[model samples]
Target: MKQRLNIASDTRINALLCSSAAVLLAACGAAGAASAQTTAHVYTMTGAASKDFALTGYDTNPLAGAGSLNGAIASAAAGAAGAQPRLLASVATANPSSSAVTTATTEVTQLYQSLLGRAPDAAGLAYWSQAVASGVPLSAVEAAIRSSAEYISLHNTAGSTVTVPATPYNYYVSPTGSDTAAGTKAAPFKTLARAAKAATRAGTTVWVAPGTYAGGIKTTYSGTSSARIYWVSTTKWGAKVVPPASSTNNNAWDNRGNYVSIIGFDVDGTNSGSGTKWTHGIYTGGSYGMIADNHIHNVAKSVACTSAGGSAIGVDSYYHGVMTDVIGNVVNDIGPAGCTYVQGIYFSTSGTIKNNLVYRVGAVAIHLWHDATNVIITNNTAAASNFGMVIGGGDFYHTSAGANNIFVANNIVYDNKYGISEQGVTGKQNVYKNNLIYKNTTYNTSLRNGLVATATVGSDPLFKGYSRTAAAPDFHLTTSSPAIGRGTATNAYPTDLDGKARNATTGYDIGAYQH
Candidate 1:
């Protein structure tokens, strides 16, 4: 007998054939002698699974009550175990449950919204749906989406705003002003401490005019994530903050607030004599703050209390926050001789140190210690220091494990006692790459206790002109310098110290210059 069958267009099925009479002959042709001796019939579907269909056996034509080819294939698969060529039909006819579709749809929508900053298009929705249906986990899909360049760009600009208010909320400070005066530009306040005390709300900007200000500044005012409070100098290096002559342990400026900014001032830590106590130029105990485009220098601690060291810019996470930004500053003459613990830029937790010029410091130019993690140091110039950079371990009252996820790249370290040193557990979780190290006294790069640099270049950086003894030094790179095109391209900063493009061409130039 000859028989014919038709299956649905999009449905798939699988079946095992046990008899030659049940063979799936094309065009209902008579079975050959070899086929008649066959013990099994095999049928496979295109995309759908046989297990997805529930089928029943039928003694007569398997396609009799089969609503579609899918049903016919299901019926054939259902009777594959029987001796007789029995047919089977699909039992349930509905698609996947509404709950499953709804869940998939919700996930797709959220992934698009969070990762891409837009709604999903039809093609994208279909692609992700098929991917999920094919056993791809939603979390994996979300991770891939978040790792895209689009998501990175969006994340970098997440809390920034564009619209400027017509009249900014500003308070003014001046040397010849009174504390009782209104903080307006016409009648400014006398002290930064008074201005800070009055500017309590987010988006408040305290503008300090030209002149030297005495006394330490400490504030506890916090700002919102989107609108940060700013303490700015009207003229760079013109507004100076100096510690009181009698104060021993006072910092020039101490901020303990979150989401604050200190910009474009000069902090002078006057190291009068050998017995002077420790004092920092700018000490920050808050998070989500910025210390940028400032000049901090002359910080020191007395040898009598050598353990009480200070730093030019110190960031500590005593207020339970992270993400401080220290960029584009110049720190010089920090840690006079015989002071073993002074630092140029000292950070205790998560932060970024980039595009700064730090020179002539007594101790480490940049220090990352005390449970610091996800800290990045890049594109800075550190010369004439005891150590260029130190990723600290459990030394000097820091009992925690060393820093984790520390990245040091594209820096110029020269004329220092040690180029880069890793002490204690700090060396274990660090990545050092693309740095230009030369002319150090002892070692170019030291990873003590079984640590190693991920990548390093120990050679003369070939700068335009640099001298450890010169009255004024130049750090720009020459055209033929090896560091001209040797840096690893990074998204940490867009511009170098001299305001040049960080990646003007194919590759980034090492150190603080983009030549």
Candidate 2:
């Protein structure tokens, strides 16, 4: 337990009150020995549990102004002859506060001296007049200073609204010459490079309408703090967006440190089964980015960086400010056939990996790495992968702990090598609760190495019409399923797969789905 010093009892210094002058002297020294007041007994302050007397009853003394400077203000005002109150008020106004008030007063006085060529006496009437108009309140003067244009110019920021481009580049690349020369919907650019070149703002959204354009595209543009860069699909129909198989050229979607977002598109990696690849799809090393409502499937492999495989959605190498919203996306059958390590959707540090359906992932479905603290992994279903989900040491450099405060709840995980596994288990505080796990018999082969409730491990999750190849899987609970009304009483799930409300009065089922 911690210790502290507390007050015990009051040590009163009793003295005979002979006159009003003596009364004044006693009052000033009532708390402690001083010039005008009598010495009131004060006790030694000791240990935490002890109590000490707080001194009281010294207001009647007129000469008790010696202890503090504020008492002197009242004494000066009372003894003043005619205009002495005005003088006291001026002195009060001129003296600055302890922290910033002193500096402001000195600066204002120097400004007066700089103009009048002498210290302020009666000639400083303009300064006193300004203070009087300001209503003698310190707050008003502070507000006036803060509200100035000079202060705004020095301290204000443009932020996300002003710095980024207002309108995204709506360039459609088709067979009949791109939207370049004509610059209209009919006269579009031949390739994606022309559209990327015209991108000025950070989140300059470039909507690429469906139609196969030959060759590869490369862009080296960085967005600002307020703006970002985006490349998305414009067609209402389901189309595949892929790079040329024969070419070695690549496309770069670099966000630098700006907020970026990309929406709605699919890349065909197969290229009729020979296994072509692209550089990257919706890549970001910046912050405050979102990649949602898109279908990014295939791309030609990159020779420059062979290790960086084809990723459906990627958040490679970013830090604290990287707040991504990867939702409502459909990423299926990702990674090459023989690749050892592949990921369907990936993130680290403050990401919302929710409301997404991922299946047939070659390697790890949802991979989170590197000190990825406070990541909300909820309402996402994963199936048919070597591993359902894997979390590694996100903070490689920080010696204190790898990852802390990871909230993994209400996700439907099944049929993988491990339900969830952690390699660097040194100092990790992970919260795993209220999830539906089944079908593979054993939750994890290595029980001692993993950290999850043994009671939560069981058979098939019994999803409603849960198919492998359907456009969307139905995860609603059947009437006879054990998962119904089997959730924790305190942490009950609210909704099902189709966005319907669960049991409100009696509490609902477990996992992300409601019903």
lDDT of 1 by residue, 320-437 (tens): 5589989878888887663558889998878899888898888888988666778899989899888998886454343365677788888888889988887766645677888888
Model 1 ranges off by over 4 Å: 1-168, 271-278, 301-305, 395-399, 448-451
Residue-level lDDT of model 2, residues 278-332, one tens digit each, is: 5445555556676655555543232233455545566654434456767546666
How far off is residue 55 in model 1, in Å?
72
- Which residue segments of model 2 deviate by more than 4 Å? 1-179, 182-187, 213-230, 235-239, 249-257, 272-281, 298-310, 318-321, 336-339, 394-401, 425-427, 441-459, 464-515
Residue 85 CA error for candidate 2 (Å)? 62
**Per-residue lDDT value at 125 in model 1:** 63
Clashes of each: 6, 47
Which residue pairs in candidate 1 have backbone atoms (N, alpha carbon, C) closer than 3 angstroms, thus clashing?
Answer: 7-69, 8-69, 17-40, 17-41, 18-39, 75-88
